[model samples]
Target: MRKAVLLALFSLGFISCVSVKNLPQNPSPYISKIDLVKGVKQEGERIVPVPFKGKIGENPVIFLILKNAEGKNRVKFRLYAGKTLREEYEISFGKPGEYYSRVIIWQGLKARKKGTYTLAIFLNESLLAIKKFRIEGLRQGP
Candidate 1:
């Protein structure tokens, strides 16, 4: 019938418009969880998670869990002391196969100042996650 045809076309157009608006802005891998840990240990091709408080000492480690990560990708971590950019670290992945889930660990970062610090994680130049922590009882030597 003519009425059925018009209703079908209307539904199709409405569905297409809704889907277009729901599309993700960034097609890069998604980070499911981010954690600040003291250190990481490797065991049989896996990085073991370590316990950590919101406050850290000299060296700080960052742990990230990502999903839908495939092919070559770059991850960057920016550390800020208060509002000042303190350190930046980058990691590159060049794997052939697709990784549905991946674990990344970044270490060897030394916290120099004693105050609030913010860690920003970027996936292929896009901001993915952010975390804040504090450092106390830090002794500065002259």
Candidate 2:
């Protein structure tokens, strides 16, 4: 009975390690941080900064902030525009020194049709995080 229970536990652990299909294609890419922010706004006496609050579809812009320290930071993004991954962009992120390469997605983008879209972030060929957002009308009279 002990051996049977051990085998079952081992099998469960192994099964949980199934591969993530949507991860990056590279093996060495390192991602330090990823954040989803609302539209950029100008704080008093300061330059443009990420807004603190806004709904996903209500905001005028969305920021995909990727950060890394090593030289192998990379980005592979799939923009699901309806029923499939209609748009994809692969970008090589620069080595983290003074800036985190920020990928900005503008709302009301003619390319971004209205529907539910998901943004996936990968690190070192592993699925690090996934952010889901909806694209709606732009903030009027901005």
Candidate 3:
């Protein structure tokens, strides 16, 4: 009986440590390119998260690429889905500056059923840019 219990615990530990395979949620939301005119560029876009789509219940991760001119920058990006959906993505730009993000269900809500979803990228708390994306049944490969 003790051996069986140990085996069960071992299996559970291994399962928890196993990495989950998710798809890139598409269109690759990113900085794309920055046309810096002397100062740090305040321009950004919501690119489709590439190479992964993810499962229905799986929490989606987001990545942001910040661009600056002349020097590094301390900037942030805000995301909004609905009244209860919100995330503030903070970033500091350096070489290969990539910010990681995730999507969570608020008020038992999923983006697909919520109709239109909006993600607003802000520079210093003011609106710099906004991007729109749709949630459909087509998921990225796991």
Candidate 4:
């Protein structure tokens, strides 16, 4: 009985140490680029993130490039209006094979009010990146 108990403990120790790497949840995945850009513009064959003031009607874009991602990953986006949490979104990633790399583009977002805002990106409940931007004032009619 004592030998069986010792074996069980050793098995549990080995299982705890053996972890699947390259997952966003474990040890965190690698993020090559995370940018809050105005929009994606094609210059030649490459798309780039351009900086500009975010306006009310215009859509705010986020471009991200990730590496070392595996199957079934969760990404969360939070937009905080000052100290209050204003907007939130959850995204999933499922790509075949290991040593994964991909470019993710998020768009079609608008601000409700003109103020300073913070954008936070999380990978499987882990904070991956954060950005700060301001939405301009509303247009006035003459």
Candidate 5:
């Protein structure tokens, strides 16, 4: 009876090991901070960033603050205008295990249709964050 129990236990352990080995392992990317802000000048000196409130038009900015990002990671930043892609940016991380931040700004956009727009950020093909803002009033010409 003792030998039978031992053999069964051994077989169970072996099966567990094999199952674990066969399971797919993927590393999860971590983001500490993300904000969609509008760019405004303070006293005409420097631009200050503030959180978006579903309203923006002239100058829009997306802030991506990251932590624990390591090793050759590709990050994609995209801006969309009512289901149409406006701009895209891809940033690459060269070193491993570091913290970094990036701010993307759209300067002097000409006559965008008054509607809601989307800003999406992706890390390694996974969407990490998204934000939306709306432009009111008529389209301002360039």
Candidate 6:
């Protein structure tokens, strides 16, 4: 009885391990690390990032880093307020070699009301990343 229990437990563990190994792992191969910042400034040859928090002011920037990017590619940005789509933008790049650690920026996104907002980024029609932020304390004009 003891040997039978031990054999069954070992078989179950082996099956679990095999199942885990067979599971697919998927991650973006081109872009990583997306952030919403107040602004970015170039100091000498290095780019300095200013972190943004709480209520955003005029001109918020979307900063992201790219890796292993090659050929011609298109990146699309979609902004949403709650479930409503607010704005959409697209940019294209054509290069021959692989891009390792390239910084891309998007500007001119305005949030006029007080609510939660979502930014979705797509690379060549594939969804890459999403960021959520909130805006509060805006006075209505008379």
Q: State candidate 6's TM-score.
A: 0.67
Q: What's the best-to-worst order under TM-score? A: 1, 6, 4, 5, 2, 3
Superposition error at 70 for model 1 (Å):
1.5
lDDT tens digits, residue span 55-97, model 1:
5765667777887787778888898998989899999876777
**Model 5 over residues 22-113: C-alpha lDDT tens digits?**
66643455665555556544557544556556656554566555665546678787778889898888777656655444333323333256
lDDT of 3 by residue, 1-142 (tens): 9999999999998889977688655432335432211112223653333323333222233344443222334455455565445666566543345433332111111233533455666554556566555454434588
Q: Which scores higher on TM-score, 2 or 6?
A: 6
In candidate 2 the C-alpha lDDT for residue 76 amounts to: 57
Off by over 4 Å in 2: 1-35, 38-48, 57-68, 95-111, 137-142
Candidate 4 stretches greater than 4 Å from native: 1-27, 41-58, 140-142
* TM-scores of the candidates in the order shown: 0.69, 0.45, 0.36, 0.62, 0.53, 0.67
By lDDT, the better pick of 2 and 4 is: 4
Candidate closest to the true structure, highest TM-score:
1
**Candidates 1 and 4 compared by lDDT, better number:** 1
Residue 34's lDDT within candidate 4 is 73
After TM-score superposition, the amount by which residue 133's alpha carbon in candidate 1 deviates from its true location, in angstroms, is 0.8
Q: Rate the local accuracy (lDDT) of all candidates.
A: 0.77, 0.52, 0.44, 0.73, 0.64, 0.75
Model 3: lDDT equals 0.44
Q: How far in Å is the alpha carbon of 99 misplaced in model 3? A: 19
lDDT-based ranking: 1, 6, 4, 5, 2, 3
Q: Count the backbone clashes (under 3 Å) in each candidate.
A: 0, 0, 15, 0, 0, 0
